[model samples]
Target: MNNHFKTAMDQVKAEEALILRTSSYLKNVENKNVRRNHFLQKGNQIMKKYAVAAALAVALIGGGSGVYGYYKIPVNYLSVDVNPSIELGVSMSGDVVEVEGINEDGNTVLEGVDVIGTTVEEAVQTIVESATENNFIEEDGSSVVSITTETDSDSVSEELTNAAEEGVTQALENENVEAEVIKSKIALDRRDQARELGISPGKLNLIQKLQKLDSTVTVDQYKDAKVKEIMKAIKDKKKEVKADLKEEVKEEIDQTIEEGKTEIDQTIEEGKAEIKQNVEQKKSEIKQQVEQKKSEIKQKIEQKKAEVKEKVQQIKAKNKNNGTQTTVESTTESNSQ
Candidate 1:
């Protein structure tokens, strides 16, 4: 009975040891499964992170390319050119007349009457009639009266001289200033006149004088010395008047010039100020534009980042079930090439 009891105790001990060994083996298998699951979770997290990073990088590259393209677009430019030209002519028309005679007082007098007419023929007839009626002819047929008309030429100089003498004689009689007719000449000395008048030749009143014969003076005298003396006196008086006028004009011109210079300087300064203001305004505008573009680019980049993040999340979810996939598609569907 004692030996049987000892053998039963040994059998119990062996069964207990076997049970402990089985429990230990099960615990180790559970630990290995837990480690494997943990490793898989970590790998999934790493793949998701890589996908997010790749999408972000691609989006950044695309956004950068878009910005580069936007900047590469050109703006239009413009500009203008200017050029600037003058023209200058003269016109004339009129008739002539002749007169000659001695009055009852028997003073030797020769006269030519001009019948001032629009037509040359009528003017001549009127002049002859007037001379005959006034008994101003010596009745010599050789002293025949004639009428002539000229336009735009120096050929009328002789006729003009005669007319001037006659007119001067008539004027003398009218003024009751005794004067005898000798010689007359219609002289046009632009340089001399301009020099004597102390004015630009363009400013001279030559055109005004040409418009009316009454505006001009006719010199009538028998003695050349007397005429010269009279001309000298007239020239001296004109010179004195011109000198006085020039002095006054010069003073006024100087005042005007000074005022104009002041105005110009002020205008220039104001223009500079305005230009500076405009430049500042333009700079501000440019800054605003740049800032606006930067904001737009930043928004676009952020949007792209968000899109990339979303795509990465989608890829992560898809890869969680189907694993990651890389696809490349290329098409060369050319009609000619």
Candidate 2:
């Protein structure tokens, strides 16, 4: 019984130790699971906050209502062309988003200028002022400043064109720069074409139209040419064409008058010839008729003369016969006597 009790106590102690170990292991596992759950909950909260932030960011960017959308979106492209051609990319709010020089002189004109974030008018004025300082624009009223607006929407283009014109005019007046301000609008495709040719759309368009009038007018020749120069060339070409046309018309009129005079002289000569021929023919006809009548009158007179002579001869013959017979009788009577 002592051995069996010892064995039973040993078995009970071993089982208790095993049960304690199992209980400790189970507590450790539960603690680990609780910590994992807590960490997962914190991570989920963090993920939710990040998701909300990301959604808000997407909404802001996608809706284009935020500051990033306001200043970055280009709504218009205004090109200021003189000797120095500068183009301003404007935002929807009229703020300038970019300033690009279309040519070498334009780049030189824009050398230290930072016009981004300014209004369209302010940018235009600044560029004009810079150009004036650089001598690209003359003080005399000989320079022509062409402002062309490029946009997809006509309304936006017109508005920006007017705004740019006003700005340039103001800048010129402020700088005491007397210049002719020309305002125009162009499509975006034309702007792209202009950029490809390294010229402003206004200049390119002018060159194109001038090309139509004069085929010798080339973009390469006039791409860097001043607006006033191009205008002068166009004006001179038109005058030349007008003068040529006038001369052509005058020549045509002179030729027509000469031709008409020649035709009239020929017609008069023909009429004179026809009149002479008709008068000769009528005279010949009258002469022939008079000769025929005179011939008939002479024949009748001959016939009358022949008849009278015959009558006279007959009377004489009769008288002679009678006288002969009377003489014979008388002679016979005389011989008898």
Candidate 3:
């Protein structure tokens, strides 16, 4: 019995060792799974962070291109000339992308004027009003404002030109400024030529017009002249040309009227001569017809007189023969008694 009890205790000890070994194996497996899951979750989180960063970079690049495209490109160009020449660059949405003075006077006018990102109308008004204040536009003297525009399409050019004209007029009126606003469109090539000469396109255009009216005028001669002076010269030249043309037309009209009167008088004289000749010819023909009728009546009367004389002589001869035959018959009867 003692040997059996010891064997039983050894068996119980062996079973307890097997159970502890199984529990230890399960705990090791659970720890391994927990560690693997932790690693996988950390890896997933790291990948998500990389994906978010890449998406943000793409968005910034795309948004940056859009910003550059809208704000950087210029779609139109314009210039204002009032003895102070200023040029402007316009964006696609009609904002003033750039403003620059082309000369010393232009710079003076643009001093402290900030027009970027403003509408073209507002920019134009501000510039013109500033010029007025600076005495570039005189209150007691008349002045001219020339606004020129250049663009890819005629419609846009006209629209911008009209807007500029309105803006200038409104500003001048508001300040009680006495000035004339002239609007025009400048071609691209002409604009470049104006830039080369260091003049606004509006001034260049006016100079060209002045040259046309007065052939003696040169572009360089009036390059530094004021716009008001150039406009006055043009006006005077036009008036002179108009007066000369009127005199020439009057002389031509007088000569034409004289020639027409002479032709009419000569035609009347020729008609009178023809009518007199026709009347004389008709009278001569009527007189000859009357003389012929008189001669035919005289010849008929002479023929009737000759026929009556022959009949009278035959009757006298017949009477004498009858009387002689009666006398002979009476003598023969007496002899027989």
Candidate 4:
């Protein structure tokens, strides 16, 4: 049993020694990330045997908690890129997988944050809250935040960027700090320029140079750009796009108004034609009625004239008969006398 214990002690010491040597070469968080990634990949292959060995060693040394702290980090990761650069990774279970950032005034804001969840916004908010709690940004100071994901898929990147903007805004409100926030689906290819004692992830393109971030750009123009340059480029591009949309909308409105005017003019012309046709038909009907009345009056006048002439002739004939009778009576009286 004593021999077995000695063997376990020797194995644990050997593992500890190997870890320390690798740690010495990790000059900064980025270097540490690369090396830690390598170890994770290697651990996967040898975990079955290593776990058995580690378990035996732990049993002999009675340090389970110490062993757990070394192995809880996961492979999923995210990186916050801004004037201050940070690489934040998470576990599959949404726990703190890995976090890499600066150690200075405004950049080291996320040192002791507890980031858990699948949302980019929440992570950003937590970072701001951490900063706020530490008074990283004063009430009069300004800051900017940008977010990127490990997934290179365009759709995912867009979603995460949108969430990040909201998250940063919330963080500012929570911390009572005001600042302009920009969202980028594309990751910054650079790191921070924080001066440190040893080797680091190298000088990243920090966005602190973008106090004047009002320039024009396209997605293609932004490849591998510094954070400040990307800011200016995106702003300029959006302005152009907005102007184009406004022109298009204006043209559409003008076209609709012209069409309505044309339709109304046609309707008025048709109405005028219809009114003229109705007036002409009415005039023709009135003329026909007048002609019929004139024909009836002429016929009636002719009939009345004929009747008057007949009545005059009848009276003259009657008078002639009465005169002959009177003359005969007078002659008879004379002869008798």
- The candidate that wins on lDDT is 2
How does candidate 4 score on lDDT? 0.55
Please report the TM-score between candidate 3 and the true structure.
Answer: 0.62
**Candidate 3: regions farther than 4 A off:** 1-70, 212-216, 286-337
Span of ten consecutive residues with least summed lDDT in model 4: 197-206
lDDT of 3 by residue, 1-337 (tens): 3698888777765577898998897777776466434432333233334435554565577764544544434556788888898988776556688899987888999999998878778889999999998889978758888888976456567667877888898889878878877888877678889889988888899999988988899888888777888888899899988988999999999999999989988888888888887777777777777677667666666666666666666676776776777677677777677
lDDT tens digits by residue: candidate 2, 161-225: 76687788888888887998877778778988988887888788778878988997669999879
TM-score of the candidate numbered 2? 0.67
TM-score for each predicted model, relative to the true structure? 0.27, 0.67, 0.62, 0.48
lDDT of 1 by residue, 128-234 (tens): 33433444332332221211111112333343334434543453344333422233222235424533643222222322232233334332221112222333444
The top-ranked prediction according to TM-score is: 2
Global lDDT scores for all candidate models: 0.39, 0.80, 0.77, 0.55
Weakest lDDT window of 10 consecutive positions for candidate 1: 78-87
Q: Which ten residues in a row have the lowest lDDT in candidate 3?
A: 39-48
Give the total clashing residue pairs for model 4: 4
Ranked candidates, highest TM-score first: 2, 3, 4, 1
- Candidate 2 regions off by >4 Å? 1-67, 111-119, 307-337
| Candidate 4 runs further than 4 Å off | 1-73, 92-143, 149-177, 180-220, 223-243, 326-337
Clashing pairs in 4: 190-204, 191-204, 215-236, 216-236
